[model samples]
Target: MNGSEVQFWSFVTAALLMIIGIYAIIFMDNIIKKIIGVMLIGDGVNLVLITEGFKPGGIVPIISEKLYNQSPGIFQEFADQASYSLPFALVLTNIVIGASTLAVLLGITIKLYQHYNSLSVHEIFKEEKI
Candidate 1:
């Protein structure tokens, strides 16, 4: 399809992912499932950022020294047609942070399972009622 259509669909997909994640986080009763929900939300946000940065018929936001030396006009044209880099950078940073957070959450879940011998949120909360 066209550029606008592609962007529209991507945004819809991102919204759906975020909705599902929120549902899981609020309704699911397992710690691991809650962690997955958090990850899904992060992924949805990342997708939106990447989609916003996308440009149809655009090149990467990189300039080769050779291309720059070829002609100022060509360099300017390339710069004009390049996609935005900031969103990509932000997504990269987010992915790293999300992965680390997921790791820590999973580790904690494992420890909780070992202590409580169950993964249900209700079971864990009941133990903490004291």
Candidate 2:
């Protein structure tokens, strides 16, 4: 398909992921499931950001010798042809942060499970109320 169609599908997929994540976070009782939902939401957001920066027939924002040898005004052409790199960089940063956050969250969940002997949010809350 074309670039626009690809972008549309990417956005649709991201939206679906986010929706499913939200549903899981709200409806699921298990801590691990909720963590998975949070990870899904983060992934959906990253996907959307990455897709937003995508361009059809776009090249990296770097000058190459081949491009320079092709034309005298290669710099201008390169600038025009290059896709936005910021979103990709941001996504990378987000991925790292998300992974760390997930690790920390899982650690906390493990600790909670050790103390409570259960992973269910309902059970934990019910115990806390007593």
Error of 1 at 64 (Å): 1.8
Could you give candidate 1's per-residue lDDT for residues 44-123 as a string of tens digits? 99999999999988898888788778776787787789999899999999999999999899999999999999999999
Question: Who wins the TM-score comparison?
Answer: 1
lDDT of 2 at 46: 98
Instruction: Give the Cα-based TM-score of candidate 1 against the true structure.
Output: 0.94
lDDT by residue for model 2 over 1-130, one digit each (tens)? 9999999999999999999999999999999999999999999999999899999889988777886888869888778989999999999999999999999999999999999999999987884643
lDDT against the true structure, per candidate, is 0.92, 0.93
Q: What TM-score does each of the candidates earn?
A: 0.94, 0.91
Q: After superposition, how far is residue 98 of candidate 1 from its true place, in Å?
A: 0.3
Which sections of candidate 2 miss by over 4 Å?
64-70
120, model 2: CA deviation in Å?
0.7
List all candidate RMSDs to the true structure: 1.4, 2.0
